[model samples]
Target: MLSFTRGSFSDRLFFHHHSHLRALLQYRSTQRSLSVVGLLPLSIVMSGTRSINDMLMQAARSKKGAVAAGRPPASHIAVEKGKTEKKKEQKVSAPHEKMKESGERESGRKDKSPSTLEKSAVAKINEPCEKDNGTAVQNGIEAPMEIDSTREDKENGTIEEQKDSDMGLEEAKLPDSPDIPKISEKISLPPVGVSEVPSITECVSNLTKRQLEFDPKAAAFWKKGEHVPFAFLAHAFDMISCESGRIAMTDILTNVFRTIIFTTPEDLLPTVYLTANKVAPPHHGVELGIGDATIIKTIGETFGKSDAQVKSQLKALGDLGLVAKACRVNQRLMRKPLALTCAKVLKTFKEIAKETGKNSQENRRNKIKSLLVAAMDCEPLFIVRLAQGNLRIGLAEQTVLVALAHAAVLTEKPPVAAAQLPGRLEQAAQIIKQVYSNLPDFDQIVPALLRVGIQDLSEVCHFTPGVPVGPMLAKATKSISDILDKFQDIEFTCEYKYDGERAQVHYMDNGSVEIYSRNAECTTGKFPDVAGAMTRYKKDDVKSFVLDCEIVAYDREADHILPFQILSTRARKGVTLSSIKVQVCVFAFDLLYLNGKELLQEPLRVRREYLYQSFVEVPKEFSFAKAITSTDLEEIQAFLQDAVNHSCEGLIIKTLDKEATYEPAKRSNNWLKLKKDYMDSVGDSFDLVPIGAFHGRGKRTGVYGAFLLACYDEDTEEYQSICKIGTGFSEAVLEERSASLRANVIPTPKVQGRKCCGCFVSFLFL
Candidate 1:
């Protein structure tokens, strides 16, 4: 098993930005297109700057190419006019007159005139400067041994003997500032051809070997080790947007898992939770409590849309997330959005869940709006969906587990093949599913799996005292014969199924007790007596264990169990011993966990043996259910009859096969329920007042035969009309009652208010 610390990967990747880029490149090359990766650069700021530099370098290359291809040199061209141009021109031309005269004298020839073309060319070459304090010019070929003082030279210093110099060469270097290359041209990317693309597996392998992180500005891009842009999940959503089949979803989810496994495995848990549209497991009790009204208000407030506008969109689109998406798309005033990450999304959800006090709704609304503000385009659509818990991608927890299992298998030393992947995946998924059934929290499961592996994770999966495990359920059967046929050649046990609330009672080593209902909701206070009764039986073998039983209302004086109605009178919470009215008994039928070890895999026979030996039984207070094991149909029928006679609902037939084990969140055939509802019984009656009559069809078409009835509520001081009395009355009874009801039928305007206020019809027979 591999042992590791949290944030180790993040620390390694965060500080080294280049390795992050290398990972990103490998990821893009191997899995998605570069265009998809374009928006999510490893370093957003640096990528932008690199693009600008590339453009500038390309322009410099083009300019150098133009020069080598015989284009005019930039520096030698005519210069643009500047602030000092006139003064510079006057200073330069002053030296030309002397140089021309000196050239004529030196050549020993009278220079009567120069060609117009030659003069203009000379003027252009000598336009900017004269060397050595204006002693040189464009026209001068050479000069030696001169002593003179021009207006400009005299102001500077005394004239002395000077040497000949080239004026045209000096003019070439006169321009003080260099010209910049034009950057107006467009740049294009190379085309992606078929030969350039890589396989998904290859891409995954390459990504696994590299590290990745986002730019600093994208620091908001990660939350608790999860990266941003949200595009990764969005892309996966796009792939399965229209897919419906389980196989197709599994394929898509498997790929998504592969993507996360290779790129950002830290996000796996949050992504799974989000995909499941849950903040945490049911047992963990984390709830967002965000409602439609809150989401609507947030959309209107954050996106600048009016309630009417949002309502109109909702009327057209039906989904609030879609409405939010539309509003954001059409918003005139949009804020620059920070990249959204799985971690950030989960963090926001956690904060929203943790908010309490009087202003919690307001605080929650603000947090939700803030998240919406940071979302862009399709991101808002998904963000709203996640907030609303309406991800509705047709993915369930089971499918996600399967996907995670596939990812785990692929991450193995010798990767499982695609053909053999499904079988291995199923095996991995069952282990996770079983563990989750007991632990029931992805927050605990996913991290453990990441640190160790599936095998080690299965070992850690055990029933804890405080945490509730989903109780195993049974399939319903109609008769004793049906139950016998199902377990024909097997040894099965039949126990009375009591008429009471199913509770999972956990006794912790600290001497604390908790009782949870079948739905895994805490009902500890409601069953205070049950907890107190179990404390007496806390032996060495049963100090800390989970017991599955039926908590029934008990009549202490009569020494018998009461109906479910008596138990229903108990308060839900804050049940005080002094205030107790409905005394109850816990009929424990099965033991799942004992002394901190889960016996869920033990056969029913073994579990029952342990359950019987663990604790002392007290009649009608805390005792195991009466059981009789047999294959005889007649004996089972007698036991079923005895259960009904003793006020039990019916019988619970449990399979005693060696392979029979407790499977949570599933209704297996190994356990069967036969309730009294399937048996014959005398019907119960209710106190109902006759209201109006309905004419029967066909046989008594014209006559008012059936009567409408209502039940009286003592507390509300109002009568609630319910059910129609159409079947019980005979012709003789109806005939004797017809006249009395007619005379007593009150007129609509004359009816007076009392216990019953509507128009009344009283039957004399009653």
Candidate 2:
């Protein structure tokens, strides 16, 4: 049988000693006010009464010394083995039921005339009077209604529903307090304060009222302690059925946090809706706010600890974790900075039932011993989490946001929607927070977040597909130096290039998949891991997701990717999982089409921001390709060397500027690459871009090795080869070159025939 119990250490202790009268007697309040004491159950008093009742009934049925009684004592029913009521003891105890409800005892506090001896003398008169029987029956059902719920009442939720108007109170599921010993020592508990009910009602009533008095411009409802800063967020696209986007809800809009700032609640529906579709990738890592680092440092200083110590403390609260060391190398998982989590604030007097112990395991069986509610959301994925980066199927921050929105259970969607909702983020969030607090199920959250705003709740499909993602690279590279040198001033960045195949991974609405290589070839079978990763990480019922990544080969450990040749291992049919271990590393460079929103025209900076913001971190085996400043030949060289050292051939540098479009099948200059082997050896730089090729001859007959190479004749409208160099050759290269020639082969391909590529076309000494 499954058992559900929860509570904190203090709560458990309280539950264990709940029934002790001696403990209650230590509290003057319970002793002075019987009315209050009677409301709560005291098992000991009742247990004594049951025993007395049984003995009394047995004695009444006994005949006092008839003929049979004289024959033997065997028929005499003794209450105990060697005990009996004393013949001289005529005193009876006061009926506990009457003593419990009679508030006349409180009258003594008002008028203290009776002495202790008088009270003792009067105690006998109050004992078992014939009138006690009538009062006992009436008080048994009415006065002792202190216990919250009967077993049956709790099971059907009749008591909960009736108590709070079906507000989900039954879900609390707290454990039962244990029986207390009558003679145990007292325990002290912190004072409990009653919330100001009227004030709470006031805040809840005027929640959505526009033009609130405090500060119309500032979105806050000046509450005690601190003001809540709220912003309303909305979603921005349509999606397909298989995707997280709720196509029907794409149009939904909401302002969640706006109201929450001024003491208003969040607008959970729209935010949840926007998140459902993954408008952004699902990473939760974020750049620290201005001065936040200093603040952390200051706090650490005040605590007389190093930044690391402060950070560790924060991690204990689930606020911080390790980070990556460098872009080129494997992630270092450092904890340089600290942040916070929802669990941090909730540590105050709040704990789950599963966290406590005290009650017997058997007694605690399936007892919904205790429950606590809190609003929680995921942070963006950092470089530390290898797989859950901006790649094939890792979750990003936006996914978490969506999940949170859905958790709120507002009008089916998060506050974010297709329509802009920057003005409403704060308010939308509060509402969602309430929803999340009440119900924390993933299914509930996903559907709500995916629901397109302003849609008929009856719509079968919520998410849409074909959302274009990426135009997000920078422009204006006067020199590689311009990118490398000026990045910091504008917070710009550059990334490394990979020599593997680039894939435009499409997640179809029908739950199908298609992976298109840069050359527009369908290479889906060549990389099954890509599809499998997506299927697993993506939320259930998500129909589609289109991603951009580099597919490279791998050894047994998926951490390192092999060269292009290794990709051949998976190029053929009937490749068993173990037979061919050259797995592929789909290096996710960016997020293109997530859910239904298209980010095509957005700048590279914007795209990267979205990518980083959306994804939640997962560990290595998959990851986002690291990036840096585009220029600084020195840095680029270092990066290129790093890439090469890691078995990569080159580095592709991307500008953070967003003017460039990611033209699939088109090699635009915006994304230029520098290979480790491309440096000039003797003199002049080669102008070959692998333009066209010719049929092979001689030893290269079956293969296309001695094929024509091209140099750009800028003056002409065509490309002509200055050389046809073919020196670096291997059997495998010969075969691959032969196969690749069919597409690039030109009918009238021409070559200089005299000298080959990389050879000095000596204009110097000629």
Q: Give lDDT tens digits, candidate 2, residues 163-232.
A: 2111110111112222221111112221223221222223323323322222222322233222231111
User: With candidate 2 superimposed using the best TM-score fit, by how many Å does residue 655's alpha carbon deviate from the native?
Assistant: 3.4
In the range 1-766, model 1's lDDT, one tens digit per residue, is 0001112111011101111222222323332321212211111112112232332344355532111122111111111111111223111122334533433343343442322111111100011113321112222321111122211222333222222222111111112212322222221222223222332233322322211111112212122334634655654564555676667666666666656655577888888887777887765556788877788888899878787777778767867888887877765331234557777888899899999999999999899888887776677788888887767566677778877776676677675676876677778888887787888778888888888877678876666778788788777787777887888788889999898999998888888888888877788878787788787865565678889888899998999989997888788988988899888887888888888778888998888888888988877688889899888888988988899999998888888865578886787888888876665542222558876665557665544577767775643323566766668766766765565577554323112332233434332211
Query: Any runs in candidate 1 off by more than 4 Å, and if so which?
Result: 1-229, 306-309, 417-422, 557-560, 565-579, 679-766
Best by TM-score: 1
Clashes of each: 2, 140
What is the C-alpha local distance difference test score of each model? 0.61, 0.36
Estimate candidate 2's alpha-carbon lDDT, on a 0 to 1 scale: 0.36
